[model samples]
Each structure stands twice: as C-alpha cells, then as structure tokens.
Target: MSNEHITTGQAPKPVGLYPHARRVGNLLFLSGVGPRVAGSGPNDSAVPGLVLDHNGNFKEFDFEAQVHSVFQNVKAILEASGSKWENLVDVTVFLVNMKRDFHTFNRIYAAYFKDNQPCRTTVEVNALPTPIAIELKCIAVIE
Candidate 1:
C-alpha cells in the first residue's frame, strides 16, 4: 500500500526535519510533539517554550500546560489524517522524572483521553529537550 504524509495548521511545526505524521495502509505514525509553537502564520515567529523543570535548569515548564499542548499537536495531526484520538491504538509517553510527575501526568492525561484508553507505555528518561519533563508519540488507525 502507498503511504502519505500529513500536516496541519492547528499544531506546532516539527522542531526538526520530520513530517508531523505519516500514513501507510491503515496505520498512521505520528512524531513526538513538544510545546513549541510553529507560528501564527508563514511569516510569524516560531516560539520555543518549556515543559518541565529539574532544579533550576528546566524552570518555566508547566506539566499540565505542556501535556495539553502535546494533545493539541496530536489532535491536529490526527484530524489531518481523517482520524481522532479515538483512533489511537498505542501511545508511548517519555518522561524525565516519572516518580516526581506521574500523578500530575495522569490527572492531566485523563482529561484528553477520557473513555477509550488506548494501549500505552510510560518510561522515565534522564532528560528531554531543554530539560522538559515529558514527550509523547503515538500510533493510530484510520477508521
């Protein structure tokens, strides 16, 4: 089956050289999304923001805020591919400090994925971009 790349205006632009999402057959693969804003438009500024704080290094990062931002980013990609969160099959959550932020992460995560909780895996890592706490990548099916 042929594959297609998906992009949307509603989410933050990819920080590096990568498509937001790609579809092959009935599966859609989404890249990890962070809290940076692509821009208001083509000529606007790209704003890079924080998502967590470790000691004084990751200061200004907000757990809930970044989680919501990641969801919005995923939503934009999914919608572009004629899918939604309900179509998600698996999700991988990466955290800088799982012990410190697991509870807060679950509380905020529940809001976005209320009913059909997809298969998920959460892992603690040593660090993230600019010391951010969390980053999420997912896979979903197109109807």
Candidate 2:
C-alpha cells in the first residue's frame, strides 16, 4: 500500500520537516506532538503557561498545561489523518522530567483516555526538541 502524509492547521506546526502524521493502509502513525500552540514556531511563546528568559531558562512553567496541549495536538493529528481519538491503539509519551511531572501527567492522561484506553508507554528523557515538558507519539486505526 501507499503512505499518506497528513497535516492540519488545528495543531502546532512540527518542529522539523515532517508531516503531522503518516498513514499506511488503516494505520495512522503520528509524529511526536508537542504542546506548543497552533501557528507557533518551535521557539517563541507558543508553549502554554511557560515563559523563558533570553537565555532559554524557565521563568515560569506549568506541566499541566503542556500535558493537556499535547493531548489536543495528538487529537488534531488523528482527526486530520482520517482517524479519531477513540481509534487510538498505542501511545508513547516522552517526558522531560518524570519525577517532577509523572503524577500530574498521569492524572490528566486518565481523564482524557478514560474511555478509549489505548496501550501506553511513558519514558523520561533528557529533553525535548523544544521547551515543552511533554510530547506524544501515537498510532490509530482509520477504521
């Protein structure tokens, strides 16, 4: 089968040169979705509830906001790929600081995935490409 690249104006532009998602047959695979608001670049003040100084140090940060925004971004990509939130079959989460943010992220994740409980794995990393605290890579079924 062929692959279809997906893009949408509802979600933030990807940090790199990639479409929001790619579909092969019935499977839709999303690129890593971050919390930066739609129409915002990798830098600037796109990230919700976060402020950085001239040197890129966190002036104010809110993990909850990032978590929620990432979910919204993922949902947007899914819909754009001819899928929906309920069609999700797998989710891999990237967290910059699991120790400081896992509990909050878990709570928000539960609220969002309460019904469509897809298989999920979360890992802590040194950092993300941007200033956001959380990112999500997802897979969903078109049917």
Candidate 3:
C-alpha cells in the first residue's frame, strides 16, 4: 500500500514539520489537531475565544469555543482526506485540564457524535504545544 501525507488550507496549519494527516491504504490518521483558526500561527491569539497577554498569560479563555473549534478542525481534516465525520473509527482527545473541561467537552462532543458514535478516549495533559485548550487525534476509514 502507498502512504500519503495530507495537508489542507481549510484546517489550521500544522505547527511543525508535519502534515495534517497520513493515509495508508484506506486508513486516514490525523495528527494532533488544535483549535487555532486556519491561517493562524501557533503563538497567535487567533484561537477561538482565547486571548493571551504579551507574557503569554491568559487574558481570556473559553473552553466551549475551543471544544467547538477543535471539532471543526477535525472535520475539516477528515473531509480533506477523502473521509467525512461519520467515517471516523476512533478518536483520542487531549485536554489541558480534565476536571475543568471534561463536562463541557462531553456535552459538546455528544452533540457532534450523536449519529456517528466512534470509539473515543479523552485524557488530560499539562499542556499542548499551542495556546488552545483541546486537541484531537483521529483515525478514519476512507471508502
């Protein structure tokens, strides 16, 4: 099977030397995707409903917005990879603070995945490489 690296202008540009996703055969594996808007840099304050100071301190933060934005990003990548939201087979979520965000994330997640319930795992971490609060690593099958 041939492997392919995928990039899309519809989703946030990757922070480093990595494509948004990789496709092997019929499987599409997405890199960790965050909530920063498309065409925004890693350190920019373009994250949906998030703001930071010059010292990178949080000036404003909205977990709900981040959650929605991340999902949008994941969807964009999936479509760009010849797949769709319903094609997702598995998803792993990363949150900066599980206690503070899990409830909200779960609420929003349920709405998005109501019809296409893919296997999902969520975990807390100290931080992500960007200012966003959530990220998603997804796997989908392209039929």
Task: Encode model 2's per-residue lDDT on 1-143: one tens digit a residue.
Answer: 86889889989988899999999999999999999997787665789989989888999998898888888888878877788999999999999998999999899989998899999999999988888888899889998
Q: List lDDT for all candidates, in order.
A: 0.74, 0.89, 0.91
Global lDDT of model 2: 0.89
Residue-wise lDDT of candidate 1 within 75-116, one digit each (tens)? 778898888889998999998888888898898888778986
TM-score of 3: 0.96
Candidate No. with top TM-score: 3
The residue pairs that clash in candidate 1, if any, are 53-58
What TM-score against the true fold does each predicted structure earn? Answer: 0.81, 0.96, 0.96
- The worst-scoring run of ten residues by lDDT in candidate 1 lies at 38-47
Q: Which regions in candidate 1 have their CA more than 4 angstroms from the true location?
A: 38-59
Which runs of model 2 end up more than 4 angstroms from their true locations?
none
Ranking by lDDT: 3, 2, 1
Better of 1 and 3 by TM-score: 3
Question: Best lDDT goes to which candidate?
Answer: 3
Task: Please give the distance, in angstroms, between residue 44's alpha carbon in candidate 1 and its true position after superposition.
Answer: 11
